[model samples]
Target chain A: MDLAPYLLLAGLEGLVQASVLMLTALGLSLVFGVMRVVNVAHGEFYMLGALIAWACGAYIPGPPVLGFVAGLLVAPLAVGALAWAADRAVLQKIGYNPEGTIVSTIGMLYILQQGALLTFGPDARAVDAPFYYTIRTPWFGYSSYKLFTVAVAILLVAGLWLLMRKSKVGLLMRATQFDRETALNFGIPVGKVYSAVFAIGAMMAAVAGVLVVPNQQAHYLMGTDPLLLSFVVVIVGGLGSIPGTIAAAVLIGLSDGLLSVFFSPTLAKIVSTLLVALVLIFRPEGLFTVKGRRA
Target chain B: MTKLQVEGLSAFYGQSQALRGLTLELSGGEVLCLLGRNGAGKTTALKAIMGTVPPSSGRLVLDGRELTGLPPQEIPRAGIGYVPQGRRLFTELTVWENLEIGLMTRKTGREALEHALELFPVLRERMQQRSGTLSGGEQTMLAMARAMCLNPSVIMLDEPTEGLMPSAIAGIREAVIRLRSEGVAILLVEQRVDAVLPVADRVAFMDHGEIKAELPIAEVRANPDLLHHYVGIAARPARPATC
Candidate 1:
């Protein structure tokens, strides 16, 4: 067993996993931060993105980049539009009913999953890599495509950080999260912001699907595991905190990566699940929290 | 010109009505005090006028523009500023962020913010501080100052003095007076009748979602019976000692 190759593989894979986890967490965290609803349908949104990517690949012609980009862009936007409509038509009717929101989201998840299976059959489809060329590297014997995936993830996180901190829209988003009524008083157009955030969050989830499609392939049911894993990451990170999400993602990725490397991957999954349960029991607020912020 | 006019404004929270046929008019440069007991619909009137709550069927005109059913954000753009009850500051946002957010909805740039901070200079010092941790009085000032940042024609405050010390309330009164002198129409919903009587030209007493009485401040002051009758607070008549 060559140690160097395994380390390279694990690091590259872990980085990719972290990126997807971060993107998936974005919507879940945003919805929770503002509306206080744990949207169980978030996974369905991811599934929608994957299905879109698969459909794009099936119909479209050209290199993987076009299909991947099409899937990345279109899937999330469609899901976001769906999320927006759901919010206005269904969620708004209940008017912040926690139990109602939860049940509705779960219902949405089932509807979407069944809808995906109906539209695109249950069989998994291979998704070509967006970039197939391999780079000649001495130590890290990985393709350039995988390296690009890692780079893209880093750049996106950086972009998200800058947008959140430096932009006026970000300021309004943070303000609205704190108090929607007060944000409206400031003329922030609270309704529009809610829509934009849901859209953007859905977009992030789709982008994650696009990135992972090359490795994992696309299927009607590929998003379920990511959804569960991201929830664990989000919970460990402390709900709605960006730094918390990334930190928790990295922790989860590294832990699972190392454990799977040492023992069986199935054992690693069991341990991570146990760890999450332990954390929930011991530190209910989360491993890292600056006062939970009420939802 | 009259900045805010409410004709037969009524609001409902589900089946129970909050504001029942409330009518009032406010001209520029006037500070109209809304004095009432708790749950007297003072806040409801302000929320209605600012378009926070939809009036079941009533007329709201602000500077000649009909504003009956506009949303809360639209009302501010229509030149109405509101400081809600409980100082409803975004507890997670910083003081500067809260103030800057007021002008964000407006097409105006940093100039509006500079003007707001210039008026309430204290916020300039505590710009980075989170609003939730601010003292009750400081939060009150922040809320009022944030509303003023919008530079709206009419400024409506819902209980700006609630849960504050005497000095803070006095500071707010002074600010209202200053705002009045500047020709900004002010509607202050307050339980402290004495605190506002000096600056108020007219006072409206409300009970059970209706304005039971409206009179000049002098009339309200001279006849503390009006206060006792509607608001349940008696203005102590200082009796001369018999020599």
Candidate 2:
């Protein structure tokens, strides 16, 4: 049997996984980079997005595509607003103390997980793809929607790069991240920047969740795997470096895909976990850390 | 005209008091040097007025506007610029971004950028360089230029020459003189009597968080013991007054 088709399928799968992982990890990186606070509840935001998308499909009257689009528009905004409120109410009150934020976000994670369980129940549910279009090849057929996801991910990443480089809001965020006291000295409203950054970070995860809902089932406990995977990506990429996050995501995502196809899913996860450990021991600053830049 | 007034300002860090009912006044186009020994609360006084350290009790009025209890971010918007000790530039950002952040609270746009560049012309050439990569003297210039970009009516300098060489010190003195000529009120904090004497119109001696004496530069010049008593420095021989 020719291995070309199988390898191509694995590569495509890796690209799709990498696309979602990058979006999710980028959100985690932004929050950690700017706020210096670990958000343990990040994956819950992704789970919430998927569940919200499922609800939109089930309840909204129209084609599956309409509900998917609605989910795309609504999930990020809703999740972002919730994240903002949480930051102001909990994170700010704690002064964003590193240890305190970790515990607080853990509490948040449980609350969100339990809330989803109570609302959506324990069963896993799936949503239809917005438009079922397939690209057929002599060996096998592929889902065009998966490719569409990759395209969307690239656009979002480009938009983020432009926002960081060219916009005033981006400048404020960068300043705040570099030196909070200096940022305040120049009237950057560091508090507002914190709230906005927290929200935007959660929104990134939510968008990824919405995008991946068609391919994966929405379950209350689904957050665990993505949460773990995202931590791996962010750490391997280096803390606070967006380009690093992207490169790491692709590295880990593709390796996981190929490993799973050739070996086993369990082995794939073990390899990723071991990769993080190796990176930690060898390159603690991350694979793409810039010299003199804070990690 | 009085540009800033601090009436009985006090501040604390935890249970320890840093400023104790400190009072001072700054007028347009004059440099008022706040002189004190280490830990005499000179930096705290500036921090209190800037709202970085919330004054425990007191009133801060800038040009007849009550500044007490305003957030730190709002202080710069109220026409008071601060070049904090250590030249706290956003080191990771380019010199231009640092200046751009200063311009955030002011609408002077390109004109303010031009003014700051004029004050420190070397900064114009180093606009795109990350502030952290600059030499110490250049960092000081960038810090001052960033503050100047606010087009402030009043500006405060907290030990701007603390770690600088003599040439850099001269650059700072010249910049202070130029700022005074532009009619911007300056509240300068300095330990070096020579550095202060050239640009300051008056000096306020602070010890243990309280202002002990306020005198004209000539008064401090005549009373050598005052410097020895408050700041612990022997008075230098009289030279031609520069201000």
Candidate 3:
């Protein structure tokens, strides 16, 4: 058995896992950082995206590429709209109280999960990737679609970075995150900004879902793992810190992939959980967070 | 002409009232100072005008435009700038970003920023630094500069010189005088009467949420006993007037 080849495979697999985890965890961190709401239903939005992609792939009368394209376009927008409606109709009405939003999102999680079960049925489904090609490496062959997923994730993350750093909307969101009352007094419509942030966060998760659905089975309960992993990532990374979330996602994702391949998936889970515990004990603020002014 | 008018304004915090039928007016290019003890509703009056505190009964008009009951976000758009207490600078943001937020409701470009920087040159020097790292005086200057970026017809400042060295206080006083000269109405709420009085065109003494006396600075200067009775301190010899 060539251990080098196995390690290389694990590394590639870890990259894929890290890519998906980055999108999901970034969304979670953004929502928590700005709205200060623990969106218990964030996973449901991911599940919804996957299910939506499945439906688009199955029903859209076209080639696999067309269906995949439709799913890519429609899933995120639909989920984003749904999240915005939730913010306006439920979260905003509750004044976005931290404890209240937690409860409300828990209720949303159940509702979304059950809604999928009732409408989409309990069976798991998969969507075909738009293109099927392999890139043969020295050790083995890898799916081109998987590499595409990595590329798309990198592009989207870069775009998000620019949006946060350069755009006026990003400035308003940062201002609102720092001090809601002061932002309001400055004539920034903070309520609208909250809705936009909530929508964008859900959209990021949905895009991740759309990207990963071709490889994984889209089930009503598929959001469970992503949600749990994202929570671990954000906690280990530090809440509300973007760069920290990305760094932590890569660390956790690579470890999970490498460990699961070398040992067992259950062991990987235990290790990650223990790692989180250690991080909380030692550096509760996360690994990559800056020491300056508290956000 | 008066740029802002507060008629019969009242505000309450849950069960207790903070402002009781407070009425005041600020003219264009004139600086009006409100002097009062702590808990005397001086801050509440400013908050009510800014729409941070919901007015129970009042009418706020800015240049003949009705402003009462408008949302806090809309108040800035209606041509009023506010520098709230504690210099609420977005601590994590850079000084430039903080100033950008001040232009949230206004349509101004780099020229507006340049004007603000001219007023507080230290902010220009520390444009890239996080606002939290600024000294107390610099933070106050940044807060004032941020408000000025709105290009507002009227600006309300609450304790702009609180906890500052004499030099920083002088800077704020100079800025106030300059803004007045630029034809911007100024509504100032301050406890530092000695530092603010020289810049004020008129002073209104507030006690128990009501204005006990309103008079020009010259009239208030003439009656030292009135200053002693209302402010608990005799009016100091008037400083050589400027602005």
Top TM-score hit: 2
Q: Write the per-residue lDDT of candidate 3 for residues B1-243, one digit (tens) a residue.
A: 989999999999999999989998999999999988889889999888887888899899999999888888999988899999998999989998999887657876777788889989988789899999899999999999899889989999999989999888888889998899999999999887687668999999999888988999888778878777877887777665452
lDDT of 1: 0.80
10 residues in a row with least lDDT, candidate 1 chain A: A286-295
lDDT of 1 by residue, B1-243 (tens): 788898999999999999999999999999888888889899888877766677887898989998777777888888888889898898877897787787666666777677666666777889999888899988988988888878888999887887889778777777887788888999988887666666788999999999988998778778988888888988754222110
How many backbone clashes does every candidate have?
0, 0, 0
Clashing pairs in 3: none
Instruction: Give Cα distance to truth, residue B172, candidate 2, Å.
Output: 1.8
State the lDDT of candidate 3 residue by residue for A269-294, as single tens digits: 99889989998999999888876533
CAPRI grade of model 2: medium
DockQ of each: 0.60, 0.74, 0.76
lDDT of 3 at A291: 64
lDDT of 2 by residue, A55-97 (tens): 9998998999999999999999999999999999999999999
iRMSD of prediction 1: 1.7
Question: Which candidate model has the greater lDDT, 1 or 2?
Answer: 2
TM-scores of the models, in the order given: 0.90, 0.96, 0.95
lDDT score of residue B61 within candidate 2: 91
Proportion of true inter-chain contacts also present in candidate 1: 0.74
Task: Order the numbered candidates by DockQ, best leading.
Answer: 3, 2, 1
- Report the C-alpha displacement of residue A276, candidate 3, in angstroms: 2.7
